[model samples]
Target chain A: MSSTASSTSTQIQLASRPVGWPTPENFRTVTVELPDLAEGEVRVANEFISVDPYMRGRMNDVKSYIPPFALDETMTGGAVGRVIASRAEDLPVGTAVLHQLGWRDIAQAEASAFRQVTEIHGAPLSLHLGILGMTGLTAYVGLTRIAGLRSGETVFISGAAGAVGSAAGQIARLLGAERVIGSAGSAEKVELLTSKYGFDAALNYKDAPVREQLPELALDGVDVFFDNVGGDHLEAALDVMNTGGRLALCGAIASYNAEEPTPGPDNLSALITRSLRMEGFTLGGHFDLADEYAQRMTEWFAAGEIAYDETVVGGIDHAVDAFLGMMQGQNTGKMVVRTA
Target chain B: MSSTASSTSTQIQLASRPVGWPTPENFRTVTVELPDLAEGEVRVANEFISVDPYMRGRMNDVKSYIPPFALDETMTGGAVGRVIASRAEDLPVGTAVLHQLGWRDIAQAEASAFRQVTEIHGAPLSLHLGILGMTGLTAYVGLTRIAGLRSGETVFISGAAGAVGSAAGQIARLLGAERVIGSAGSAEKVELLTSKYGFDAALNYKDAPVREQLPELALDGVDVFFDNVGGDHLEAALDVMNTGGRLALCGAIASYNAEEPTPGPDNLSALITRSLRMEGFTLGGHFDLADEYAQRMTEWFAAGEIAYDETVVGGIDHAVDAFLGMMQGQNTGKMVVRTA
Candidate 1:
């Protein structure tokens, strides 16, 4: 085995399972010396480690679609990097790659562990972690497949300033939605939803009850609800949904940090009254549409029709802070750690 | 109009909209002199008036699939009767018929308003209000069309001793469900579900919390949940649902009489974790399958594969008591007012 004589990786590991909300004490920073590369191994320096809401679910020691993160181990998630050294035939030096080795500065693994990607018009490598990657795909699949959004229907997306929600709002408009409404936490994000993301109306959920505000904006009733915030947002969507409405349950950031289970929508009887359908899904199950989505997204990007934002924090040491900030609605778009 | 000079009709009228649970004061019994039948009118003496759970929804003045019953007007619903006098050709004096002019001893309406239904091998005329009528079709639609129950899947039903729930359990088995479980408010109803309705297991919801007990009974997880009582029952179902499970929301009797909206399941996050689908529907939208359901139900009844029970309250004066009793979970099966 050929060795990298002096390379070290800075990583964040789960120190303890969070109770209610996570804090700095729940994580531990570890520095590990890189080992010798095997015959087909590669050494990659991560550029940006993605922080997402779904990752919070994995930190808990519970059964879900994806297994829980092992305690006292490095966090594993989406990251974009450049393979600086390799023993593989296909992926040589300076190959930009994407891998599931997040919350770290250096990733050393088998060559097959990383997927090669190209820089788009000299854009930042972190673009692969947000709009052009899994985040965008999550939004696309939720609108087209999970919600079955049809042309000329109205769409309402919660957490509209966040990664998937921002992508979803724009995608809904492109899908021929007659009207698009969104809910976000801050006045700035609410302004951005209408000014930047093509949302017809936006609600600053922090200002007033979502249920009260949604009706004022969605006067005709919502035809589709792409839910990223569950709790009150879900109840609000139910309150103003048209008959035969569809709800795509993508995330529940509302109760993600709750010590006890949060009570769901009070008017679920609307499901029966309006003959509604509500489905929950994750991106892992709908990869069949990846190729098609990539093609459409690239076209949309080239035409200057798609817009995205990112909130990047510097240094690997700040990854925990970045995650906590994202969870607390501090991020306007995709939250990513510039590990490099 | 030629009058039936000596004949009279006793009718139950909605006195006012109910605030919470309805009491006898919410209804008023009135006797009216019968007017003579017009050229196309018929005077039918009702045999039985169906006092169903859905009727409670009509007592509230809210927008729904069906309009609320008008105050000071006779309540209208499913009723089976025989034509005592007819001014039309299709229906003779002895013809058994069905119509939507219930809560009355005599229904005198245009001939076109009543439907002719033949007695099935000496079965009581009231059977048309239950197994051979809308009640049975409700169960069939929830299982097949709404939940999409396939052969060899496990099914769970709430309010299993009630009309629709009882039929759903039997029909789920007939559709080749591997197992059928049910929950009822009393031990006797629970016993009847297993003994008479062919349920694989039955839960007396009064005995324990449904969420705690469901896990012990539904060890393998529930695939289809036919919900009639939708408060804790919905939460319990969410707790034990398998991946890709489906829920058919038929009724929410648990909160029907509540002055305020009921909080839904706290564990709705299970929808996303398990990638589950929940849908709500009423029989009105699925009436296209009514003929198919009726054919199958008659066959099941003939072959002794379908069992039914009715809590028949004698006399028109006690009709309010029957409805109140059914709402309080006093009935074992369909509750009816035997007017004849």
Candidate 2:
């Protein structure tokens, strides 16, 4: 490993802005010698790095909630690692912590910037980047708060097999939803949705048009739609939603990498006729609900009431591959890079 | 005249469902003998009849909040008329009443069906249909309740020269919107938007692309959008919306006549990135707020804080012309047909 013998860190930097769908050429790998830890600073050796769909939006230099990733700089994201060298007493060596200094094998940061996460209770440390982290919290808050999910309401979510969708399906069920339905891209993912994630019905969008297949799955019109995949999925949801339906616009991974502006749903007028409401949200603006989310998700995880899956790509060298693969629907769940 | 010595009422009936933009052939003129009033019924000599954009949706055979007009039957809508004859003791001749029995020179309905309007205090009786009635109520509820309009926020409205839009523009100004911008189809209507309706800036959408013209109009991005015209107008609003912008999806007159499904705004992903919200509403569901809307609008009108306009086409013979003309954007404000 690069960390052996020499005090050096390896990191991936944004080489250039991608014109469309990103490839390996957009990133460059480099090794830099580490400096001695300064007062109040600690050096961390990362264990797992999260790769998410939202990161694709950050690569573009457009104004968004989060600033675009700077060119020639290491990209930042959710990561959990152990402190190897420390000048701060609070973050001592061998302590596991979470920080936003990902895209590198070794992260050096102010101790205050790293949040100590001692134990996730029987789950791997990676849960700090997956189900027990932002991924799980987003699903919980989106359904309960954003969509105003109520007991006995039917909930439909797109991108069911993805990290957020998988968690959302189980969360909806636990929240007393009468029925939970989901859609994924592959037959295996569809099977996994019902067998593992507890989705009452799952659709393989590749087999038929979502609008055609969704109606049968939603015997009565859907009351709430958790929209992770936009485009045709949104159109289908609009078609099948009941009057006064609520849609939580979580993610639009379907058009995240489109080279040009894509066509919107043809049936948005249904929003007016049905008096539906669609509200969009991102995680950063909703950290206030994190504690509640963590408590519930932890209990659910411990009791086996909720299940999570991770698509692990071994090594920091393949982080870009994992990100691209996740974007392409190649990963079944949370796609992460295990740097250690 | 049909209401004179003849004792016959002339009404317009839906002849056939139009394929796209409605034509005169879709309706037929008929004069029928008046039937004797029942125990609780009153005969009204209609004065002013309303022709609204939403009436276009009722012309279709599809189910909606309001049912489709039965084939070969006189279509129903909002109108203000005077009670000419009554079997009920509460309603006397010459009492100005408001009811939903439009599309004719005269009407016969139960006494409970008509709401009596004694006086609008210097405002014309027709104000009950335009500024003091459903049109004005729709604008008030949409901005204050739906969009949650706050002081010092910029407001953008599409179809700003029409009934609800015209009222909405003035209401936004009264609500302490820092700036009010509106879009219209013609230069005349655009001028009236600023000169009469108090819009800070107005765009004649026909002169140039709204997307290109809107950015300069909404300098800091709009906080609230009262969407009366959908399609490209909605797309333009999405392009220039600030974070947490609220969109009140009031109408989609732009697509009301669309022969086929029209593509929605391509930049809907902005809803997620900007944390914007779009909610759809109809007037019927919000009648509980009618008294509040009436009191506020009446006070605003009495104080000259609001202005209203009417585009009148005389005679029941020209009601179809008025309806078609209003749909074609020929009217600048509330399009009403006068039978008296």
Candidate 3:
């Protein structure tokens, strides 16, 4: 290994905006010199980087729940890292922490921006960012608070193989849901949903049109629909929702890259006929509920009542590729970049 | 005064389905002979009748939360009347009550089918079917439970001069909404919204397109949208909703008469960006909260904190004409037909 004096930091920054889908040309990797730590700031050597569909929305310059990222800035997201130098009391050198440090091998941030991982109840450090972090909180608040999901209700989750979707499916089942159906884009995902994740049934959306298949899959009609993929998936879900159905609108990956706005479905009349409730929310907006969610998720993980999976890519140099690929539906579960 | 023995009953049935908009030709008034009351049944001498937009949905044969009216059957709706004669122990002569007795001047109903109004509250019989009945309860449950409306939120009510909309506007104001905006079809109704009902602002939808007018009228953005007209009005609300806005979808009067379903604006993207929540509901499903709503509304009325208006049409002979007129937006506030 190279001496500390010879080691340097590597980073990827937004080079340009894409017209529709982003490409490699839109991003560039650069080597940067490190600066001395400032007061109350700790220097981190990143070990894992997160890539999520929400990042696609941030790349656009339109108004959204979260502000758009500035041009030529380091594309920011959640990461797990180890502190190399510290000037703060809470975080010391060699402590593992999670933060929104973006796609960089090394970062200096206010110690308060980072949450120290203490291996609580013998949990892994990566699980801190996956099941016990933003992703887990999203599924929890959406099902219990937004949807008001009741026991014995049926839940159907679209994009069921993704990070948030997988967590939602299991939690709904554990919460006494009578049936849980899931839709994924691949057969491998379908198998994982039923075999490993405890989903009652899983369908490969690529095998059949969801409009035709969804009704047959959910014969009793869906009481709650956790939607991650909007557009056609929303239209299809609307067609089969029961009277008094509740839809938790979490993400819309399908429209994130559309060149033009998708037209409203002809079936909105169903909203009146069925008396459905559809609500949209962001995990960041629900941060106040984090402590409650962390406690519950911790208990579930400790009891082995819940499990999670992650796809880790090696090295910070490959962070951009992993991110782009995940957005393109290449990853089977949560995609995280591990910097060696 | 004529003796009760000579009183004959008249009923109106749906003669044919309307192609675009219902006309007199779609209904046929018939004279029906009186039937003797059986044990546990009572004869209701119809005193007032209610004509509403929800009846339009029942005319269609499509599946809905409420069963559709069969061809050649008397159109079903809420009606208030005096119990002329009774064979039941609980109900007696001269008691005013409310029931789903359909479009008829006189009807024979089981005592369980009607609720005694005069015994519970010493208010006018018409109040049992309008302000203190389904219309009032709808506004109460929608604002409190469905919309999760907080005090001081700004509200915009569509179809603001109509039955449920009128009630919703006043309730929003009484509940401490800072700004209440309403939209009606006629200029006269707009004036009534602001002057008589205490709405902060009112607009005549026929004067200008709602799409352009909404943003100008609601400069701060709408926090809650009480939607009675769901086509362009819903689209306009989507354009001006504040972050975390809540929409209470009570009815879709704009689409009730469409020959084919109209395509409204595509709004799924807006839902994600604004983090809005839209829920549709009917009053009958929320009957459990009726007692609580009635107590609150009664207190508000007695204290002069809330007020209501009605459009009364005299005589059962003109019931069809009144029903058609109300559906065409000719009536202001709640439309009630006085049969006595």
For candidate 1, the share of real interface contacts preserved is 0.96
Model 1 docking grade: high
Question: Which residue pairs in candidate 2 have backbone atoms (N, alpha carbon, C) closer than 3 angstroms, thus clashing?
Answer: none
Pairs of residues clashing in candidate 3: none
TM-score of each: 0.97, 0.98, 0.92
In the range B75-114, model 2's lDDT, one tens digit per residue, is 7888898888878788887789999887888898789989
TM-score of chain B taken alone, candidate 2:
0.97
Candidate 1 residue lDDT tens string, A222-288? 9999999999999999999999999999999999999997788899999998999999998878999
lDDT of 1 at A102: 78
Give me the runs in candidate 2 sitting further than 4 Å from their true place: A1-6, B1-6
Question: lDDT of each structure?
Answer: 0.92, 0.91, 0.84
TM-score of 1: 0.97
Q: Which 10-residue window of candidate 1 chain B scores lowest in summed lDDT? A: B1-10
Give me candidate 2's TM-score against the actual structure: 0.98
Tens-place lDDT per residue, model 3, A1-340, is 1135223578888888777888888888988777666789888888787888898888888888889877888888888888888889888888899899788888777899898875765665667667778888888888998888999999999998888999999999878899999999988899999999999998888998889889988999999999999877888899999998999999988878888866666677787678899998887587888888888887888789886788888888888788878887777768888886
Candidate achieving higher TM-score, 1 or 3: 1
Model 2 Cα lDDT, one tens digit per residue, A1-340: 1133226889999999988899999999999988767788888899999999999999999999899999999989999988888889988888999999979999987899899995856788988887788898899889988899999999999999999999899999999999999999999999999999989999999999999999999999899999999998999999989999999999999998899999899999998998999999998788999888888877888888978889999999999999999999999878999998
**DockQ, each predicted model:** 0.87, 0.87, 0.54
